[model samples]
Target: MGFELPDRSVLPRHPVIVGDEPRQSGSGAMFCHLYPANGQPTGEVAGAGAADVDAAVAAARAAQPAWRAMNGDARRDLLLRYAAVLKQHAQELAALETLGNGSPVMMAGYAPMVAAQRFEYYAGWADKLRGQTLSAWNNPAHNYVDYEPYGVVGAVIPWNGPVFAAAMLLAPVLAAGNCVVIKAPELAPYSVMRMGELFLEAGFPPGVVNMLAGGPEVGAAIVGHADVDKVAFIGSGGTARKVLQSAAENLTPCCLELGGKSAVIVFEDADLAQAGQMGLSGAISVSGQGCVNGTRVLVQRSIYDQYLAVMQQIAGHIPVGDPLDPGTVMGPVISEASVQRILGIVGKAREEGARVLTGGQRLDGEYADGFYLPLTIIADVDPASSLSRHEVFGPVLAVTPFDSEEEAIALANGTDYGLGAYIHTRDLRRAHSVANQMQAGMIHVNASGEGMQPFAPFGGMKQSGFGRLGGEQGLLEFLQTRNVWMNLKAPQ
Candidate 1:
């Protein structure tokens, strides 16, 4: 079976891009405008090239000294102000996010809330940024390490969760005192542009945070720009590879959060009803666009049919409509290309002999204009099938059976991606062992989803990309430690 798409009118609304902004996407509505690469906006997108990047970098360099000079309290206060401003504009922000990225308005609302919490979390950390104290190995002396921010960070965000991911990268980077030049993904640049207004209102100096809307050339230029100290990106592994190659030109440090095809495990002893709901929720949440979504479900063979029946029922009930509709549960994908990519994955699944239980066809006529693919459930997926291994980035779920705990572990850990994994079992000891054995950055026991927490580290262990994004560990991602040593006693 394959995925089905809804009719055109089910499409999400798009926000208008403010004047002179360079925009893309077949649907138009001006989602983004290209800014000057050097820090000035050329009337034409082409003219806003290298010189614009240079200008932006120069502006950032000039502003960074003063920005960094602010005491921790001042920085924290500014972030607190920013948080308040974001809260005040939550509705507007949520609407913009939905319109720009085709996410459900409800999920879009979560962005502002999460962003606010992230700000609050990092705000509290600003004044507490500390290094280490240690004894000198070879001398009667004490040594300490001081943490400092790297100047001029280049942030390259993706379209899936534009506002939320940008806020995630921005909060800690800024709170740590680094000036930023963001290259917002072309697909959803409007959301980022709107955010700049909030940052300015919150009193961040101009050039301290700059934004640009363009494609790979722009990202390459920003990454290789001589003045940039580091680069942060969230996107596909293919693009991540290119970004890394580009960043290497200047030896700039990079933080990457790439793609994943996470798995969910269901043992016979587990709760089938709840796990079924969780499986559907894990697969369809964000329309299956999240990196950590459990797209692959490994059910114990004894209950595979029962579990599949429940999942199919739940997936069939998911509402596919306008993202603006308060009652809508799932929305259109960000672009037509995304739809094509998703359908292409389905085609491959069929060729590879997977059984599509429901939603394997497109809903034509009315939904022709909307880029939406129906939630798809595939059963009897061959262990070696591409559908079980790759990220479809759509509302597609693959179910395969496992005969034993070891088999379940093998199936879940087979993917190159190590973002997250899910396990459900009544036996606590078995759950613990499985959790420890699963080859993923995060694991959910008896649960089918993962979420961000301020005190826990989040990142993958394999091809899913590197570095933590939350907790004290995540804060350190944006900081550089400097070691200082002195002899408290007489020098030997």
Candidate 2:
């Protein structure tokens, strides 16, 4: 059901989640969300401070036991109700994201839709949680094992995807009966802060979920809080390292979904059109701000030129304009500094001999003040070049060609990152062969759309990050295994 905003055509503006309500931030600094479409300040929100972080963690600690004591059926129903709330307010949430993060409204809308679906899927598993019943070896022993929730989870969100992040980060934890203290994405904190109100509206007990809007200092506080049991972080590699170090001081288990310099491998037998589409999606979608954007693409020598041509056409047609416009296919990157940083990366790649197949500069004339970057495809990039080695985190695609299956595999696995990779080919044997050797945690085999579902395992290998965040595996991450043993009075 669609719900109308009582405030009428607006968001909470500068909302921040504190316990079960949307409250003004007491961090003393006002955060204004600027519209990247035109470089205009659209809204503001309260930022969290160290004190706020302490308050949130304390609230979550106090509420965890009661929340866990409630039967699974009750938790399931509450989550389902939350899903309804998400669905009802999807439009407003989408708008808030666009105004703050520069994501197109349509793309922003999909996040919440995905969130609601995931909530329902995880809700179904709440009452279905199973423990293993062990067999005895004629020794009069009765043994079994059960799962229990970690008392308080501290989750740090990334700015690129807010609504969807909440789904993957919170659904499984909540499904397992744990309370959470979220460090809301400081870059785009408004919409998530608004989510604070839905907790009570969805009938969840107060303190079950709390959010704070602050920078790295607040995040450090969450990780160091003695009450926090685990930390879930999704951001850059550098930040993940810091989070890991801090969480280690307290021996808190941490789930890191860090940066990626992933590659898209398009084989000779792959459909050129489909490969081009995936190429566009990997580097162009969300303005390539996603952690798993396969900016480095390795196409087989036989199809390399054709695939490049298709990619050029795709690049030319990608709409760049106001994020609020329904026709816009691409929006500006997060900020003006981001625009300059991406431009610098492109300039360095050109200096290192990579040819700019299409756009390589920021849109100047009409889009002068905004953080606008035209779609750019850098062809003939060296595998060892900085463009190919590091995460650009912008709308830049670097292409290289490989001659054989072995070379393709080498190219795909060469990077330090192992978050995600894409493979486009028709032969099942080749697909399986290459996939077996690919080092990434998640591989899209001739498919697309982030490779995520409520029940699918999603994470990375190597420096990209660790720990799973979906399905039974995700549910398990939030739980600890406990063994129960008893001696039978008489042998059965």
TM-score of 1: 0.89
lDDT of 2 by residue, 385-416 (tens): 99999999898999999999999999888989
In order, candidate lDDTs are 0.76, 0.84
Candidate 1 RMSD computed on C-alpha atoms after optimal superposition onto the true structure: 6.2
Candidate 1 lDDT for residue 93: 77
Write down the TM-score of every candidate: 0.89, 0.95
Clashing residue pairs in candidate 2 are 14-44, 14-45, 48-213
**Residue 127 displacement in candidate 1 (angstroms):** 0.5
